[model samples]
Target: MSILIFSLILLVGAYAAGLLGSLTGLGGGVVVIPLLTLVFHVDIRYAIGAALLASIANSSGAATAYIKEGITNVRLGMFLEIATTAGAVGGALIAVFTPVNTIAILFGLVLIFSALMTIRKKNEHAEQTGSKWSYVLKLNSTYPTANGEVAYKLKNIGGGFSIMLLAGVLSGLLGIGSGALKVLAMDGAMRIPFKVSTTTSNFMIGVTAAASAVVYLQRGYIDPGIAFPVVLGVLGGAFTGARLLTIMNPRTLRIIFCIAISFVALEMIYNGFNHQF
Candidate 1:
């Protein structure tokens, strides 16, 4: 394809990815990778590079709105980043040598799991108590509500931290923000409010992607032509999505997240098993 045609295709795909990513905290990379590799016939490594760039843009565009709204727990996100950044560096180094098929299969499985996890009942109002660690670290916080700011607390800090490490590893290996797993860690394991988990995810994904991006750059996976269009499109979409998220129903958000990921997961898995990665 001509450069202009390729760039246009990437821009459209990345825009859709970013919108869904901002709404669900999945990050644009999740969509960008599959669109690049499966539809555009790009190599997985180059796709990863583009996806990482798109994800960082997605995070930056959405995070500002979430932060301004006070829905994002910046303190918690920063605390969790310590683990994710550490794991991302190691995973990026490993991705340099990992097989493409293996990475694709793993990515598909993770998406499936994340989609399944979204089937649960309401979580934002789940009764949770602050764990001792949360108290010590001061990670507990409040978010806006129709009535006022409602407080939430953390649970299973150890479990959440462990899951965050895994999220980071996947982020680096797949060039995804690992926002799905990050949501699971905080929303499910830690008992954080779903809104808080998602917004905090938006805050953290950029930092995590940046950590691994340096490694991808060193390995020459980042292509300027692909990265530029993807980032530009994602930023535009993410900002639009962020505006809608504040008024969106949580249940509706879950449905969108599940449907999007499930479809992509199955397709990715089929292609990976067929040695198409």
Candidate 2:
């Protein structure tokens, strides 16, 4: 294919990836990497590098706006960052030596699990009253609502932090923001409010991605030619998706998102077994 045609095709794919990501709160990296490696035939390492860069762009862009809205727990996010950053660096280093097929298999499994989790119904309104760890760490906070500010309590700090470390490692290894895992840690283990957990996860992922991105850059994995268009396309698409969030039915969007992710997961698993990288 001609260079122009390839660039255009990538631009369109990246935009769709970003749109789905923003709407689902999944981040764009998952879609971006698969499209790059599976469809475009880019090397997995280069696809990872591009996905990492795009993830930073997507998360940081949304995070800035979210911070202004005061939904993010900056203190809690920073506290978790210590573990995530360390894990990301470790995972990135490991990725350099890991076999391509192994990475593909792991990526496929993670996607399948994430899709299954996404489709499972869950209550988002439940909140803890208090916890010893929350008290020590001052994890409790309030957010502004239409009615009034609503306060929330935290629990299971140790478990949350441990899960965050694992999330960080996966993020670095797969070149994704791993927002799903972060949300699971905060909402499932820490008992944080769902909205707060989502915003905080977005706030923290950019920094985690940057840490591993440095490692990928030093390893000569990031290609500017592939990354530039991806950054622009995903960023624009995410912005558009965010705007559409208010107008669209989230439940409908979520159902569509789950179906899309399931398809990608199955394809990735099939490709992994076929040793297609």
Candidate 3:
């Protein structure tokens, strides 16, 4: 492809990725990497770097609206950041020596799992009985609803933190936001409300991606030319998605995410096994 045409394709692709990611709380990197590797024939390392940067932009752009809407738990996100940052650092270090095919295969599996999890009904109004850690750490919180402020409580602090570490590792290793895992930790493990979990996950992903992005930058994985279009397009899309969050039904977005993720997962696995990527 010519330079202008390639840039246009990247821009459109990144925009779609960011829109779906922000809307579904899955993060744009999941879509970004597959498109880059499978469609554009980009190298995984550079694609990952571009995806991470775009993820940072998407998360930050969408988080402003989510935070203002009172769905994001800032304190909860900060607490989880401690574990995520540490894991991200470790994962980034390991990514340097890991085989490309291994990364692709793992990415495929993660994509499939996330897709299934996305379509599952979330228990948003589970009991508010707080765990000891939830009480101590103030993980129990409330978010505004149409009826009123809906209260929720954290369940498994240890489990949530452990899962967050894994999320961070995947983010760093694959250069994606890994927001699906983050949401799973909060919504599934801690039993946070679906909206709160997604918004908080979006809030936390920016910090997580940034920490790992530094490692990629130092290692020379990031390229300015590729990052420009991806970052701009993803950021714009995220802003648009955030504006639409209150009006749109999340189930609709989840269905869309499931279909897209399923395709990407299959393609990633095919590429990994055949060494086509």
Candidate 4:
């Protein structure tokens, strides 16, 4: 009975994660991490590990469609993978040695900061200007939008890459899907369009997760009992979210996202300060 109940919870959580992830392009980690940690009372470390696996599942399942549609810049994703993968490895290694309390506090603080950042920004549909590195790397690309195909140039390749490294490390250390930071680095720093940034970020996420997943596996964090239901539910939810994307308004999604992220951030902070392993 206990096992059955847990399975039901896992499915529900994963389903919600996938649905929200697809709708917002934030990926499943944003939803899974918090759900696992706050609702299930799972340890943060294990929660991150499970989240990483779910990320891979989410990316693999969704990226194909984006790629087929030619909205994902495979080349740009490949180039950035060099940095993010390396960073993931480094971050995972650090995770093995870091104290649990420290990890918890850091993770909480970062999530809060990320949430705040999202809330502060107003949605701007204008194309952002690319930086010098973008010109050098020729990271610019185009994608089909409702209006038509829109072309965008990359900006700040170096800055974006540098940030990716940091993002990778955080992903490794914290067990996040790291999609938000990757998007910020590519879209915010590099001035890529949101669609391009999201698709490319999705393309790169699997590699980042894979880089650290092996380490987690070796450390005995990849519990099949937990991972199975979580992955299945998230995948289902993601599919649903993707389908709903066509009908949902972007502004409404953003507002919901802001509220959700902020809530997760606060939960992390409070848990970090008060909870014990």
Candidate 5:
């Protein structure tokens, strides 16, 4: 009975994650990690490990559909993978050695930062003016929008890549999706439009997750019992969220997401400082 109940919980969590992730572009980790740790009382490290696996699942599951819809640019995603994968490896290595409290504090800070970034208005007409790498990589692309297909030129490709590397590292280290940072890099630094930036980021996240997931698995941080339910729930939720994306008011959603992240961040900080297990 206990096992069955736990499994049910996990499935529900995963579905919720999927729904919320698709809507907010935040991904499963945003929802799964906290629930695992706070509600289930799982260790943060193991929770992160499970989150990494679920992230891969969510990304792979969604990418094909997004690509078919022409929202994901395979070329752009592949190009960015180089930086993100390298960062994931580095971050995972660091995670093995870092103290749990320190990790918690950093995670809290990152959540707060993500919330701030999400609330800001996008700067349209931002100049894609300079950068040698931007030209060589042809980071520019167009995507279908409600307004019609729109073209965007690349700007500061190197800067965006640099940020992705950092995002990947954090993804591995914290076991969170890291989509917020990825979106910021592509949207803010590269000046890609919101939709394009999001799909592309989603497309690239699986590679980042894969880079560290191997290590986590080998370290036995992965608990299949935990991962199975979370993934299932998150995936279901994400699919629903994606369907609603067209009709939903994103600003209202962003505000709610920000509030949730802020609360989790504070909890993490408190736990870290208090040395609470």
Candidate 6:
């Protein structure tokens, strides 16, 4: 394809990726990387770099809206970010020496896990009074609602912090925000409300992505052509998705997202084993 044609096609694809990501709770980077490497024939490293840029763009855009809504737990997000930021830098540095095929396989596996996590039914946990750590760290906070602000408790701080570290490593390695795992850490481990978990995850994603992005830049993996189209398209699509979410059936969208992501993830794993990369 000519440069103009390639750029246009990528822009469209990235937009679709972003829309689906927004609707399904997967970050745009998950879809963006596969499209670039598998369909567009971009190198894995370059695709990762572009995906990281897309992730940062999407995170920043969504976070602004979430923060404005007063649902984001800024103190909790920032404190947990310390773990993710450290892990992201470590993962990014490790990516430099990792084989391309290995990276592709690992990414595919993580995608499969993410897909499964999305489609599964959620179990509600009763609010905990909170562990001593939550009191000491002051991570507990309230969110706005029609009635008014209602306070929430935090729990299992040690476990949640440990999980955040792994989430950060995956974010750096896969060039994604790892939003799902971050939510898992907060909602599942820390016993935070779902709204708080999601908003805080979005709040933290940009910082995690930025940490890894610095390493990717040092490695010279970033391409201006790919990054520009991916970032612009994802931001545009994310905007449209926010509107669609108000009207769409979230469960249906999640199922569709899970299926689509699984298919691409399997392809990535297949190609990796076949030495296509």
Query: What does candidate 2's lDDT look like per residue over 206-268, in tens digits?
Result: 999999999999989899889887988898889889999878868777778878887877787
* Whole-structure CA lDDT of model 1: 0.84
Model 3 backbone overlap count? 0
**Which regions of candidate 6 are displaced past 4 Å?**
123-126
For residues 51-129, could you state the per-residue lDDT of candidate 5 as single tens digits?
A: 8877888888888887887978677788888988889988999998999888888888887887777677765542446
Prediction RMSDs, each to the true structure = 2.3, 1.4, 1.8, 2.5, 2.0, 1.3
Candidate 1 per-residue C-alpha lDDT over 73-174 given as tens digits, one digit per residue, 9 for 90 to 100: 888999999999998998999997888988898888887776666566537674457889999999988889888989888889999999999999999999
- lDDT (0 to 1) per candidate: 0.84, 0.86, 0.85, 0.79, 0.80, 0.88
- Per-candidate clash tally: 0, 0, 0, 10, 11, 0
Question: In model 4, how many backbone clashes occur?
Answer: 10
TM-score winner between 1 and 2, please give it.
2
Q: Summarize candidate 3's per-residue lDDT along 210-262 as a digit string, tens digits.
A: 99999999999998878988888887777777678768778776787788789
Using TM-score as the measure, the top candidate is 6
Answer with 4 or 5, whichever has the higher TM-score. 5
Q: Estimate each model's TM-score.
A: 0.91, 0.95, 0.93, 0.89, 0.91, 0.96
Candidate 2 vs candidate 5: the lDDT winner is: 2
Poorly placed runs, candidate 1 (over 4 Å) = 23-25, 126-128, 244-257
Ranking by lDDT: 6, 2, 3, 1, 5, 4
Q: TM-score for model 1?
A: 0.91
Q: In angstroms, what RMSD does candidate 1 have relative to the true structure?
A: 2.3
Comparing 3 with 4 on TM-score, the higher-scoring candidate is 3
lDDT of 4 by residue, 179-212 (tens): 7788888767877767787778888888889999
* Distance from true location, Cα of 226 in model 6, Å: 0.7
Return the TM-score for candidate 6, rounded to 2 decimals. Answer: 0.96
